[model samples]
Target chain A: MENNNNIPIDDLTEEFVVNIGPQHPSTHGVLRLQATLDGETIKDLLPVLGYIHRGIEKMTESLGYKQSIYLTSRMDYLSAHINNQACSLAIEKGMQIEVPERAKAIRIIMAELQRLTSHELWWGSCAMDLGAVTPFFLAFRDRERILDIFEGNTGNRLTMNYITPGGVMFDVLPNFASSIKELLVKVKEHLKEYEELITGNVIFQHRLKGVGILPRELAISMGCTGPVARASGISCDVRKYHPYDGYDKLDFKEIVIDGCDSWARYKVRMEEMKQSIHIIEQLIHNIPEGEFRAKVKGVIKLPVGEYYQRVETARGELGVYIVSDGGNKPYRMKFRAASFSNLGALKPITVGAKIGDLMASMATIDLVIPDIDR
Target chain B: MKSLFQYLKEVFLGFYSLWTGLKLTLYYFTHPRKEIITEQYPENRTTTINIPERFAGEVILPHDENNKHKCTACTLCEMACPNGSIKIISVQEESEDGKKKRVLDKWIYNLGMCTFCGQCIDACPQDAIIMKNSFELSVYNRNDLVKTLNKPGSKLKEKE
Candidate 1:
């Protein structure tokens, strides 16, 4: 036993450290946050990452323009289509290829479907993180429908290397649009149930409200995008603002709120899901009959330049920065992950917040660690 | 004085919202048609993948009646695989006109490292490769998984 000095040991002064993850289920994937706590109040928060770093950027430099699409799937395993789209767009930019209009529509549909699927999973996981168990299955109930749609065309659920350089690897299946329309009805019905199960719950609101308060100015300064930023009333959705892949043709709105809390983030995601359904409904009917891909040259030699492609995932903005060296492969691929940038905001937000609020706060932050690591 | 009533009203409204959620989820549970969505994998053996005609899959050398393949043993597929999943050994044969033609000696397709990306299928110039709708590619023995389609001393006869 050591004798303490004249320092008073209050709850604030009584120090304790907790390692939140590396293997924790709520982390979504291998992300360790070392937090210094004083009686359930997080004092200092530090994110420890790089557990799932696959050196994808280095691996991409060796692969050809067409070969690098598979590597994108591993970046954000949950939203592989968005990752594939970003990479394909960069390659298309480098090689100066314009995919046909029909391909653009298909790409938009696939991306929106991916957005819906990713948000569906997020709804479930965020509910589970907040100690609500039943919504996980409810969200997956909708998610499996989306996965079957993906598996029908792309051949897998999670990692779809379907998007190619000039266009997609393959054309949309014959009944793809009709089948998706069928799933769309179910998704809308299920979303209504989700709103009931999680969104309106007092416990969920109590867990989320005024928790992880990221103010608008700080969010802007940190370059946060997607739902996290949109929660703070920042309307920076790439689909609406940048308008890639027939996004301009469709009618949709970016869901934004000024509440600047976890509940605001939750509301934005829920509303975004509704908007995604609306977009799918509008786009699926007008799918045109045309070629899905163009004839790309045998050997792709990218001109010496840099190309940047950004897409809004369920979590946040995913930036793919590619530099071409007039060769078959990319010279450098730097991913400016939304998770990485959003995780930086945690230390400022989590300070003085209760330990229970940390999970709610982290869930709102919505980090995909492999995206950060890559 | 009015602010106190407003705060109380909000508190009551929050409870109302919570009640709304509970009612909706309970309704779903009672309506069991919305609950289960699993398709039994083995039981539904007649599942339709609806594979397109142009889909690139496994690299088959197009075997004919004489047990001959269309592949000229160019070993292009071996170079295309990112994971070194394909290995092909070829031997040179002299034609009657004294021109040398490469004949396949050993063809190795390792399912262990194959990513099924269809790159090797595209690299073959001789429309010799096609991805068959064979999804049941699982095997207990690792050695049994690495299939060699071309046997030794078999000449690759051209298609009619």
Candidate 2:
């Protein structure tokens, strides 16, 4: 190795620094990674964030409780419904308002549909990251159906601020049941296609099988949640442990796998899509008839205390914490986004792996940059 | 001979997996119309696309044939807006009963900064403003986005 930068020849190491993205597609969003590489093997990795931070938490402190729910949707845009739901749950808990049963069922159905859409997008993008283009097209085809359903009812497709403080914004559409049943039938058939396309492919399996192994202990210590933790045999599903939004009334299994590798993470998400479908199927036909929103005061004021609410988003557990001084606006607002903690596990998992394996490990983590930065 | 047999078995299994993946793409490729997902935007604008009734495209002030509106100049929507997109200007007027009344002079809606969260519509007590399903709000100039929602010579409707 040539001695550059006037370093002592005897003390110089052969490792070279490689900067991967403030704009790379594989990072999923605007995230910069400083990777130290000795040839093809990674020695150390550091994730540099704050490219897409919009000061969402600080902004929420100035807005009223009703106005703050809309801002959470932009944090995890894929899991927009769940992000809004977490904020609303926090406000509802602070106020001690009992949400209507009909609204609870509707919230669960929307959250699960949002989960399916998010996972389908993740599957397509993750496959595309690994050099498979066909799955991307197929995945988006199915996701469009879900977006259309959201647009029809919520008035917006991506950032649907449908879940309010006490309950949902509006009642389910007249054909909500029939439309979801039709989509579920199509999604079930297409899931088999996903299995054949990528799950059984030998090339993909070789790339993912034991690439970046995250041990169960390390995952828990790192505060990982959702499919990433479940893949490592960590039973930290918020829906199961906490059971908010009528998730306790539903029958579904938390998907867990012990492989603790990129393949395990992929399999966990695939199985989660099925569980989401199962949950939706149980509640679709039995939507109760009642008012969608509870009659709370237009100007909602929280009690003078601290409140924390956590819900299982498509990524992981999203916790919304608010401190109120019995005011219209919150004194302090903070979000424990899953991508932030999940991003921490990156360096530990990818340190000794190849540069190519870095992409695979990141694909499995499914980092959405705004969620991390916020 | 045993090593060679093991190598051949591995090759056969790999090919089988590859074939399984290819079979799905071939099926979609053959059924083009059924599998194609995207809509032809602008080209099929009127025929294929239907903007849902609840979609929050742009804010509008619904007016009657008599050029009367329902806004009472309460500025509730302005207070509820997180981004200050809605600005209501009120002018005090003396009514025939010798009582002072606040009348809305202008309702300026800035389309640029709007997040379309529908908070303004929810906060409007008089049901004067609503989100219309006309999403084509693109304008050539930034000033064009700042629209005066109330009509030129309209008056507030009498309280029922």
Candidate 3:
């Protein structure tokens, strides 16, 4: 058979290529990975993207300031509230409108609650990716309670678009604090169950412990943020660093771990979930007795200039940049989505790891693809 | 001997961890009624449906029993909609006082393109449109989603 084959046998190497998902369960969204493998070891990994790009930034150019805020929620849907808040804060900065104290408190509370929900889903899905399915169910069970709180307070669940230019769309419901307190009670009790289900599992730990090690310099060069960067000894939590929406007054810890592995990323999020609960507890009791929304005038027009605002979403720092030419619609809008930058660090860390370990590393990075594509 | 001891330690810890997780699973399997959270959606729709009151399912123009709406055909909602999901068709008619008044002929909402962002409800100056709580909005045909919200012969409500 070797003699009968075509010429130039030396030209062909032992390595072959495998494509993992434009539609992969390993990827949280539509992210495709082209991996050159020698046996199970990935030699080169390239991420093929733009499967779900809707050109949200270009579309926002035609829409008014109020209408543009709604489009940001579509970018990173897991942290949709934070995305909306980033856009709203940018608009408020450009217009020079002071958001009311009550609105600021309400914004922080919703952002924290959403952070908890996003991390819970990440915890569940990360476990599910590693072959333990029960944790996903448990995770969803915890997440539904927070989503219910969101639905009752905001008109919608995912794309509420409740954060407007100067303030929030509606005031908190009477039961907002009571229901959150009840949710906190349940979440604290179930965290132990989460510990039992997935955190302590021997197989899960072995799979994640030393896989996909990203160094601190590499993480900084790649511009990685949120839990991914925090795992690698980067203290880049935007809430702690920049302190938007009165995060300065709140008591919480920024979680940073030096493991520089998938396990560290997972641990950072788990600790941050506790911190989120702490922030909510601080604000839930003392929502200021004032207007939930500042009076934003009709047809919001920013002075002809450039405006930029950054907020730490559950995934990472989301920077909203708007260029207005003294008009209702922005002349140009750009969303520096966190996932887009984090996805770049994947290939650098996963190049020599086995294919099975790729899932653990990728899951820990926690990409929501629309954010990347946008 | 050291290799054997390390091997035994790993095996023992693995089984212990799996067993602890399995115990919770066994407890759940024994008492599913207390622990079960999922609903079998389509089959038990009548029995277990619990949509929240503030859910923004679809945009609707609410009318009173007298068949009167509050729309003045101002077209603010049309302008406010990010994707042109709401279309207001207006016609200028000579009123009883001989003034040319633009009246609402049709308020069309395309649910297929809607993000359910509630911008229309927020932009409505007359409070004519409200997002209803009925969320089972799927249909067999896409064309069926384009609904005319204003009823035939519905007139504008007089100012209080």
Candidate 4:
């Protein structure tokens, strides 16, 4: 109490710091953020990740191409399909394998569905972060249908390693088309309801509008992608920029909002879900009938070279960099997570924002901590 | 004084957003009878999965009434397991014709180490291993988890 600002006399200008999590609900999952506060405003913030790091990259080097798909599912549990897609694509590209057209369409449908599912959950969870509990339950309600479809096809709900290297692990069931089509309509209707519920809500806007603003320049410098970068008016969507798995042929808009705030991020994802549904709808009737898997060599051995592949997961750009040395296993595997780049932008945006605003800002970043840690 | 109106508009806008959220919750609460999506899991235990099933669970080798298990002691499951969860000890015994026929001495499956990846089932060449839907795998003791599939003298008198 030596100074009027209640700063210690020795450290008069310096701020007090509080560790936000390794367990806090605000963190989403085991993310520790050390925030230095000057009064109510965040002066400086440092995000401490790797508490949940299980050496997934090191584990991948030991596992074969097929075995590594299961490990990829765990890295970003929310968007396992995307993780699996990236890994499978890397192996497919490395091995120069040709996946069937029917398989490509199926993979696109599943990937788009996963994007919608991930965004829906993100929207609901982000709302919950701002103390709106209703959207969380509503989002899960829609997510249940997606999980049902996943269980119908892949036998697992969240960790769907359905898509494999040569093609998908299995073909879409006969009823899968009708069920997914029905889900598209339901998701669309629910999305409109969600618009009324959260998007147009007054409190949501107040909490989000012009808060946690990341300018286009800063976002580019940090290499932020997905909704975070999109919110800041940067067109960095991997699906649009570099199309994979028939995404090039599909008709969909890249949802971008120049608001550069939490609201923009929310808006981007909400619109992206609609676009995902649009892509899913176009692929429904035209699901070509052909062999699901192509002729992959009995044992996969990548020649000595490096291969890189990226896919737009719900969080952001998921880049898989693989180094092979004429072996069955990858010599080295590196994952450039979307969340890692998004989280890097956090300190710049959080500083000068209130502590309450910090939570809103972090939520807008849409981090999957496992993706960051992995 | 003009800024006051703009400030008030923003304030009203914020309140309207919150009200919209509340209205949604109200709709769900009122529409409670609209197909309760949550399955009462433990109570309603007979939840059948959709077809083309990919349920990753425990591996069980089918046994007939005479207790003849399908395993031929090939040890392919042992080779397939990434964690070395499955172990097979082959017992060679002299048949009626004096030929040394291979039989499972002890089929050791450590549930603790198993990932339930169904890799063992995929590796079994004899169609011996099949993944059962019995997912209730929790046990009190770690020792109880090490399940042995084949015991001695449990083989059928005549092969099918």
What are the candidates' individual DockQ scores?
Answer: 0.42, 0.84, 0.76, 0.52
Ranking by DockQ: 2, 3, 4, 1
lDDT winner among the candidates?
A: 2
Best by DockQ: 2
Q: What is the Å distance of residue A141 in model 4 from its true position?
A: 0.4
In what order do the candidates fall by lDDT, top score first? 2, 3, 4, 1
Candidate 2, B6-75: lDDT as tens digits:
9998899899999989888787778888856677898988798878999988999999999999999999
The residue-by-residue lDDT of candidate 4 on A1-374, one tens digit each, is: 34466655556555789999989877889999998988787889999987999999998788776677778888888888989999999988898888899989988888888888888888888989999887888889889888888877776787766777888866778898999888887888898888898788776777898898899999999999888999999888888889998898988898888899988888888888888888989999889998998866545788889999999898889999999999988999999888888889999998999999998998888888888898
Colliding residue pairs in candidate 3: none
lDDT for model 2, on a 0 to 1 scale? 0.92
Scored against the true structure, residue B46 in model 3 reaches a CA lDDT of: 90
User: Which one wins on TM-score?
Assistant: 2
- Candidate 3 on B66-112: residue-level lDDT in tens? 99999999999998888888889999999888999999999999999
Clashes of each: 2, 0, 0, 7
lDDT of 4 by residue, B1-160 (tens): 8999999988887777767767777877899987456776676666643333556667777787877777888787786676778888887889999998887788889989977655577557677777776767999998999998775566633544
